[model samples]
Target: MSEFTVSGRYKNRDGYRAFETTIDAVNEDVAREHVLSQLGSRHGVKRTEIELEEVGE
Candidate 1:
């Protein structure tokens, strides 16, 4: 597994909210999916509403 620093934006009551989080995954694609799933479940945001900025170690 690798550690990834993922940054993105999600919809919020105020507007779009920026977020950054560390995730463990095999690659950047998986890291991105993880971020999407997490934010979707926690924040009730759709995949289209989430904008992925960067994914890096």
Candidate 2:
């Protein structure tokens, strides 16, 4: 499995929420998008932008 790190901000009624998460998946892009989308939807956030980083030695 591939590993990835995601960092982003969510904009909602209250304000911006900073978030980060790491996940293991076969494709990094797909995983990052899925996670970011979930965060926005679950939190009642209307807008979001995410950045993905691959961890290495």
Clashes of each: 0, 0
| Clash count (model 1, backbone only) | 0
lDDT per residue as tens, model 2, 19-51? 777777677667766776778678755443433
TM values, all candidates = 0.94, 0.62
Local accuracy of candidate 1 as per-residue lDDT tens digits, 1-57: 999999979988899999999999999899999999999999998999999998889
As a TM-score, model 1 comes out at 0.94
Runs off by more than 4 Å, candidate 1: none
| Candidate 2 Cα outliers beyond 4 Å, as residue runs | 47-57
